[model samples]
Each structure stands twice: as structure tokens, then as C-alpha cells.
Target: MTTEEIEKVTERGPAASAGVTRRLGPATGRPSEASVLNVFSHGILVVWALMVGVPLLWVLWSAFKDSNGILTDPWGLPTVLHWENWSNAWNDANMGQYFVNTAIVVGGSVVGTMVLGSMAAYVLARFTFPGNRFIYYLFVAGMSFPVFMLVIPLFFVLRDFPGSSLLATYHGLILVYIAYSLPFTVFFMTAFFRTLPTSVAEAAMIDGASHTRTFFQVMVPMAKPGLISIGIFNFLGQWNQYLLPMVLNQQEDKYVLTQGLAMIALQQGYENDWGALMAGMMIAMLPVLIVYSIFQRQVQSGLTAGALK
Candidate 1:
């Protein structure tokens, strides 16, 4: 008999298909619990979205209002859209210079972190060598050291860094950021590297590919999801960095977004231009928002795939 006829016969027989199906869990019978959970999850998500969105929207709109209008009626909208707030924040407040400085620092550090961190992680995950675990543990150990603990020693280290003082230089700050960012990056990427299939890498090796070629051409492409996820994480952390630059980059001309914002706030003191401050914040936030939105899918997929491994 055909598959359909066999099924029909089985259903008609004393050995019933209904009984076999009935023996399965509640999931086979009904989705009431799943429905409830879905509704609950969606409700929580909506609440969380509002909690995040409301403040951001407030910041965006408040950037158009004058100081008095913002202070006197906090919830009210701007009577006239003040586009000059952005211009003033960018040029007059020196946020433009800070934005460029932040971009340069973050871009260099993120690229360095991803390259070095990925190499280290790939080796740790794939190769079996003497002191491999020891080296991996050493990198992992750096994560335990807090920024506060490092600040004092780092200050002296930068002050007397070999040939020259690395105290306030761009390269100095980039090096510091890379060093500080590596521990976590190495840890995360190592786990992700382990999750990737080794068969393709092995096949590449079998086909006369050198380790470097196989890694760069084969493994790296395969690990795109993980790399993109970790890259974004590193970028966000480096871009939003405040304390490191504040401590190391003391030059006013080399000040980053965070430092510039702090200076603006300090300079504002009593007579704060809330609108300009809001405009400055929006400028800083826009890039990060765009990045996350673009890579949201990759990030979700990467994290889940790593977790499954």
C-alpha cells in the first residue's frame, strides 16, 4: 500500500495513530501556554521599547528648544525648530573636532582589536601546543583587572613609555584602548572560533593551503557572523570610551566626544544651554544607532550560534 493508504489503515486498526500522537507532550495537542508566553514576551518588549525610546525621543526634540523653554516646561515641545543648536554644538562648542578625533581613535583601535584578538582566539581555539592554555589564561586574566586598578600604574607607564612619553598622543591612546579591549575580545572570539566547523579548515589544509592562507581565506569568512558580532561590540565600547581618553589624552585639540561633552558641560556650569548639549548628544548617538540597526540581524544570529556550540 502507498504511504497514505498505510496511514489510513493504521488509523482504522486497533493500533491507532491517534493513540501514538496522544502519547506525545502537550505541545502536540495545544499551544495555549506558548501563546500566553508569546503575549507576555511581546508585552515586556513593548514596555522596554517605550522605556528606551521615550528618553531618546525627548533628547532629540529637546535639542530644538531653548534653555528657558526646556527648564520651564520640561514636557512641552519647541515653539520654533531651532536648527542653530546643532550648528552651534558642532562648530562653536568644538564638537566637530571631538567627533573626528573620536572616529580616528575608535576606528584604529577597533580594527587592531579585531585583527589581533581574532588571531589570538583562532590559535587558542584550534591549535594544540605547549603553553597554549597558559597563554589563553594569561589573556583571560587581563579581564579581571579593573580600569580603576590600572589607572594609577597606567599613568606612570604612559608617562615613561620607553623612548617617549605616550601620555597624550593619538597612537598612545589607540595602543591603550587595544590593550584594554583585548581580554574580553579574545575571550569572546575564542569561544566563537571553537563553535565554527573544523571540516572546512581541514579540507583547505588538505588541499595544500598554508595555515595563514587557510585561516584568512577559509576560517575568517566562515566566522563572519561571530566576527561581525564581536566587531560591533568592540566598536561600540571603543566609541563610547570616556575614562581612558580622559586619563591619557589630555590635549584639548585631541579630545574625543566624551571628553568634549564633559568640557562643554563643565563650561556650561550655571548657564547651561540644554539644547546644544542635547544636540551634541544626538550627534554622538546617531552613528552608534545606525551601526546597530544595520548589524542587528548578524549580532542576534552570531550570539545564538555561539551559545548553541
Candidate 2:
């Protein structure tokens, strides 16, 4: 064989030996193995995306549907947009009032818990104090306990306060929510804070920043992902909380959305208003979904930051 033919044959040896003896047409480029793997991988991801998206889409569609539509075609699109359902839900169910009450409770709880939990986490993560591990474990223990177990004790403790019971009051619910949420928030923030470079704190200290100033101005900003994630979590928990609000807030005006929804449902035993019920649920869910969508990036980043580090 000529030298030129030998060189061409040597270049094709691996492809022929691997049983991949395929010739590309002049116009058609050869597909890489990487491209094939990516196609298969993207196919899996598309399936997963559909699995997650379909349910949310169904819920949104069903919110515009009436009872017969729900029964007959739960997955089908709405015949007519039921925008009035939202208005009715807001008015008839007193969801506007519930929204205000929920705002107060959720806002108060989120602020207090984040502030306290972040501070606690900062101290535990940065300083060498005695029993620090014990304190962290204590908070973790609180996380382990069932929320229901604390309700009875919390009820009496608030009940025995100076003039009136904390039960049925927004402040009481706020306090309870803060307490319940603090443990996990602290845990998350501590892990996140630990992941931060200590040099930032040291540099701030060198510049004559007090611990308080350094924390509020520098460290907290660095920990934004963790705080926002906890805020979203606490908001969802407080928003969806039924048993606590039901047991505590018996007054009509004081009812949070979840408890109000339950009462509406209970009343519907006589006359089931499925459209209204779905509307009420959609109304209750909208804020959480919006908040999640808004801060989803931060939440995901915070969740993975520990492992990433």
C-alpha cells in the first residue's frame, strides 16, 4: 500500500474497531457522543419539568371551574374565566380581613424570628462560648418536637397573662409563630454563617465596627440568601397553618386565611359551593406562590450553598 493510504487507514482504525464504522455525507456533520448523551439527558429533564408543571397548571385551571366542570373535566381548560370567584372569595370569605391579619402575624413573626435567629446563629458560629454546642442542640431539639404538643401549654401560658388571654389575638399568634419558626431558621442561618469567610467580620472589627454594627451591616447582608429562604419557609408555614389559628383565634375578625377557609368549608356542609371553595383556596395560595416565584433563586442558592462550599 502507498504511504498516504496507510495514514488514512490508521486514522480510521479506532472507529472501525469500536463497531462505529459510519460514514458522514459531505453535507452532514458527524454527531458527537456528547451530543447523544445531552439529548437523552434533556429528554429526562423535560419529563421532570412536565411532572412538576402539570399539577400547578391543573390547579390554576380548576380554580376557574365550577363543580360540574371539576367533576367532569378536572384537567380541562375553563369555558369562561371565573375572575369573579376571586372577588367573591375576597369579599364573602372575609379574605381581605384575613389577609390583613395574616400580614400582621406573618410579618411580625418573620421579622422577630429572622432577627433573633440570625443573631443567635452569628454568636454560635463565630464565638467560642461554653455550652455552644448544647445550645445549638437545644434549638435542634425544639425542631424535633411536634408543634401540636406545645399548643396546650402555650394556650394556658398565654391565657394566664395579665388581663386577657393571648388566644384569639394577633399578637399571640405572632409570638407563637416566631417561637415555632426560630429553631429551624437559626439552624439554617448558622450553617450559612459558618460557610461565610471569617475575614469579613475580622476586617469590619479592625475598622472599629462594633459587633452589632458588623452584624447588621456586613454579616447579615452576606447571609441574605439564608434569611430570605427562611422567610419564605416561615411565610408558607404561617400561611398554611390551620390548627394553631383554629385553636387560638376563635373571633371572626381575628381568623387567619386557613382557619377562615376551614370555617367556610364547614358551613358548606349544607350547601357545597365548590367554585367558591376552589376560589378561596386559590386566593389563599396566590401569595405563597408569588413569593416563592420571586425569591426562588435565593432559596435554591441558600439551600445548596452549604454543600457547594
Candidate 3:
């Protein structure tokens, strides 16, 4: 063979060998391991979805059935819609009143938490001061503290709150909710605030804007995603809170949705109004589901934005 042909063959020899090795690589178990991992992960996700979704769907459909129907065929779909179940839950079960109380308490608590938590987080993230790390670590420590342990002390504090007993009052519950939610809120917002650009805030300051003005106008708008995300989390938590309201608010008239639901469940042994109970459950859940659905994208972005930054 010519020298050119000999050289060409040598080049092709290694190339062909590498091509064969590539083709056989997958058969050596690497692809199977990856496929198995994918299948396992997907299976776990599907199971988790079912665990969460099935109960919710069951409650939804059962809300449209009568008590007898619900008890007899728990898994069956409603053949006829019992619209009165909703009205009954609203009126007879006092879910409307409970809902209003929840809205007031949760609304106020969320507003207060965002306002206060954001301010604290921004300061911690942007400013340098004595005890800054101490204060930040203190907030972080609060997250690890068991809430149930504080309930007794909180009870007394609110009870003898100088002016009057805060027990069974809207404002009182609002305050507790704010405190309970603050730790994580501060932690999350602090991290998010650090991820934000300091340059914009500096520019705002140079423009003769006050710290307050810069935060509300510039920093706040920039941190909108984090705010919405934390707000939703606070709403869900405070809305569903049973322990605090139960211990703090004993007045039946002042019961929140969680308390009212428990009341309804307790009455079930006597009244057997399973359908109304399910309907009320749906009532309490709908707001949470709706809020989450509306802000789903914002929540996802907020959670991931800091990590990306």
C-alpha cells in the first residue's frame, strides 16, 4: 500500500475502535442504572401525588353527597349533587362566621409578617451594625424552637397583656400568628434580600430618597416574588392553625375555621352530618388552593431565584 493509504488506515483503526466502544458502552449497565433511577423517582412522585390528591378529590365529591351516601359509599362519586350541603355548611355549621374570622386573622397576620419580616431581613442583609449576626442568629434559633413549648408562656403573656385578656380576640390571634410565622419569614427573606443588587438601593439613596422610601419603592418591588411566596406560606399555615386558636381562643363564637371544623366533627357523633363536615372541609381548603393556584408561578420563582443568583 502507498504511505498515504497506510497512514489513513492507522487513523481509521483507532476511530473505528472508539466508535465500537461507544456503541457497546450502554450495554455495560450504565444506561440501565440511569433508567432504574428514573423509574424509581417517577414512581415515588406518582405515589406522593396520589396520596395527596386522592383524599382531596374524595372530600370534594363527598361534599356533594348526603351523609348517608357518604357513609355508605365513601369511595363512590356523587350521583346527584346536594347543593344544600354547601349552604348547610355555610349557615348551619357556622362555617361562614369561622371563615370571616379566619380571613381577618390571617389577613392581618400576613400583612404584619411581610411588613415586619421584610424590613428586618433587608436591614440584616444590607446594613452593618453591632449585634447584627447575633440578631440574625437569634431569628434562626427561633425557627428551631418547638412552638408547642411556647404555647403555655404565650398563653400567660397574652392573658395578662396589661390592658385586658387577649384570649378569644381577633387582634390577639393576629399578633400570635405574626410571631409564630416571623422566624422562617425572616430567614427566607434575609437570604432573598442578599441576592438582590445593592447598586439599585444605592442609586435610590443618592436620589434623595429616605431608607423607607427606597425600600418600599425600589427594594420591595424587586423582592415581589419572595414576598408573594412567603405570604402564601404564612396564609396557609395561619389559616390551618388549630393548636394556637384552640388553646388561646376558647369562646365558641370566636372560633376560627380549624376550631369550627373540629366542633363540626365533634357534633357528628350526635348529628351524623358527614356531608356538611366534608363541605366545610372543602370551604376551608378552597381559599388555600385558590391562593396557591393563582401564585404558583411566583412561588416557584421566588424559591429558586435566590439559589440562581
lDDT for every model?
0.86, 0.80, 0.88
Best of the two (2, 3) by lDDT: 3
Q: Candidates 2 and 3: which is better by TM-score?
A: 3
- Model 2 lDDT, residue 85, Cα: 69
Estimate the TM-score of every prediction. 0.81, 0.76, 0.82
lDDT of 2 by residue, 47-105 (tens): 99999999877767877877677666777889998777677778876887888898889
lDDT, candidate 3, 63-130, per-residue tens: 99999889888998999999899999999889999999999999999999999999999999999999
Q: What is the Cα root-mean-square deviation between model 2 and the actual structure?
A: 10.1
**Pick by TM-score: 1 or 3, better one:** 3
What are the clashing pairs of model 2?
none
Please give the lDDT score at residue 244 for candidate 1.
90
State the lDDT of candidate 1 residue by residue for 88-185, as single tens digits. 89997888989999999898999999999999999999999999999999998997888988898998999999999998788898999999988878
Clashes of each: 0, 0, 0
lDDT of 2: 0.80
RMSD of each: 9.6, 10.1, 11.0
Candidate 1 wrongly placed segments (more than 4 Å): 1-49, 297-309
Candidate closest to the true structure, highest lDDT: 3
Task: Output the number of the TM-score-best candidate.
Answer: 3
Comparing 1 with 3 on lDDT, the higher-scoring candidate is: 3
